[model samples]
Target: MNKTINDPNSPHSIAAEFGVLGSMLIEEEIAGEVIQLLNKSCFLVPANQVIFEVMTHLYDNNKPLDVIVLQEELRSRGLLDQIGGSEYLFSLVEGVPSAGNVEHYAHVVRDKSILRQLMAAADEIGTLTRSGNMDTEELLDRAEQLIYEVTQKKAVNEPEHIYNLLLNIFADIENSNHSPGLSSGFPDLDNLLSGLKGSTLNILAARPSMGKTSFALNIADNVGVRQSEGVLIFSIEMSKDQLARNMVCARARISPHKLSYGVDEKEYKILTTDASVFAQAPIFIDDTPAISIREIQAKARRFKTKNDIKLIIIDYLQLIEGPKEKKENRQQEISFISRKLKEVARELDIPIIALSQLNRSVDARDDHRPRMSDLRESGALEQDADSILFLYRDEYYNKETTEPGISEVIVAKNRTGPTGSVKLRFIKEYMKFMGISYQKPT
Candidate 1:
């Protein structure tokens, strides 16, 4: 009987009595409810572990927590001591309850901290157990519900439903006014795609020197100048100044090579004045090399906060890095990056224009027209993007061909509209693309 009663593992004894006492203490109306709440929410982990987690979170944020706010929080959990309470909560040290009685309460809290640790350990047993056991759809729904509940609590007085309705109305009004109806950079293309929309991903792909960058820049410049909204261009391949110079030379109808190397006296004056004017345009560029998607999101958010950033341009998608993870192959990395970029666009509620490079298979083909299959490294790019435009300049393929200066803007995948090709005038010297005159392509 003593063995059964005194044994640490015994179901009955002082330790067992303490465990029951501890659980009762946890259940009582006092600050112990915070510990109970934490256990319930995060799972009963060790009290010290929970403390460590909360402290680390606070430390990383570098802010002093308000104890009054914390006390009120405990009160909301129905944990505050009753005026004529019979139960004694562990004594309070400073403002927080003592951690001394946690061992006794372990069983009542179910050693919730230990239970959580066990669950986490069980999670690592195998991939099959971790993933296959859980119904992902149900889990996702539960998670989303929890998030909504928490966020609603935080924004209790914000009138979210009404604000959402107002936001929808504002969005409709803005889109209606800014709608680029049946107007593409090319007349034939306009007949097909109309124009890009808000909150869309448009990928432009090509082999090098196929006017992909030039085409994307042209579109961005047009959107900025014509729409009168600021456009952010993240250039992993080129510097901001270099892109700006290209834009100035293109807009001023001067040769990029001549402007960069040495301009004639008359062209020099025109280029200088044009450069100054273009500098004042609402075009912002960040030329950070090999930037991760997270950095892009942070910078884009800051830009939106500071200025009304309407459009975002990423010069080539493959250059972006995925979240820090060891991937089996480059394909997976590219896939991760593509998905993240799409997510970023959705989060920011802005259109994303990402440039891409086609595989050599496109060059091997007799038609040399870029296809969805030719998207380099990852098919996820095709899956994530709302639209994919392939830039095919015939002049690069066959110099002797009759169609020398024409480029095809092939809409391979467009979620919003029809798929077809738009023809534009590709001026190689100026590194610019212009909509072919409405009259005819002479």
Candidate 2:
């Protein structure tokens, strides 16, 4: 059992830190076990941290880790004198009674590291709140974001045995009546993707005017209204009112221009009836512009707790801001953003469908279909995503094409199943995509 301490210095466990280091030194083979629970940052004392770093370095480089090898490593780095030479290293070994409690000692070190992180976050929050730059909600949001980042950083990185995984696999096989994961509301597409799996990131890419937003909203409405599952959408490009209006158009079969103008009482009744359904739907939208990926994750977590959100959708990925200090360039920044989005999906245990814009090079090609390479600024988005989908409508490029009302959903990549395209009818007036249903022969 883990005990909580309230004193300012209670977070530090000096003896435990030494116990972990000494345990690793005694049985170098167990270095892998110690690394699993504790890293160099877990140690509170400066000298202990230095010693831990030397051991971690040796382990990572495939070098033998005994007191002799450790001493040479510290000497080569000129940290031997700084960390009190060979005598201090031997004292660490003498302190540990046995290697059996190394994991417990490492847990103590890790717990203290997390507590210190919490304290720092609280201090930062206090400083920011006193500055009076943000309102109450923004202040709370920022504080939660900081604290969540710390919690996410110390996630248990471990490998699970196959026996533990086989249990869930067998259960899923037995319960094969309903869809696995969440359904996408399309039979063929659902078969292609067994629905969107949890802890997966899916990319939905298209060029401008290809109805990416409309498609995303369609899926959101299906999950929120049809399945009664909570869904959260981050609309960085459009306002909440615009999204509501789109819902009305799609549900009521009314045009955008007609929505703005007051129609007759009969039309008004139709629009209101359609709008009422959306009002009751469990679809929440946030229209924060240029929002960072970290902010999106934080907001998603809050909604998941409060509203039981099961799915997250981000309309267009490039609009999201990346980390400020660590970004090397736009490509690297995008790489960082894409990587973080994938991490958010796994950490939150939900599927994230992030809309993306394909590079304009697709326009210059003879075949304007989007490929994996077309994922804008960062190829990392393509690499990180579990599935990649492309939306193509031939009518958009040539008004007089043979295929006028058809839209193709190209399943460019599927991590778990077969890849193929599903054809659907596109109604531009109402901004809706419908699956093609075949009639039985009379």
Best by TM-score: 2
Candidate 2 lDDT (Cα, 0 to 1): 0.83
lDDT of 1: 0.62
Q: How far in Å is the alpha carbon of 369 misplaced in model 2? A: 1.1
TM-score, per-candidate, Cα-based: 0.60, 0.67
lDDT against the true structure, each candidate: 0.62, 0.83
- Residue pair clashes in candidate 1: 30-79, 44-112, 44-113, 45-112, 45-113, 46-113
Report the C-alpha displacement of residue 322, candidate 1, in angstroms.
1.5
- Tens digit of per-residue lDDT, candidate 1, span 1-442: 2222122342222333234333333323232434333332232222323332343233234434333432343355454443111122232222234445554444434443333333333334333345665554334433433333332222112223576588887887887854453133444665565556666777888899888888778777776765567789999999988898888887777878785578788988888887676565688899999887767776776676567687888997888866556355788888877886787677556788899988888878798878889989747888899888888888788989787778888888888788887777788878888766523324
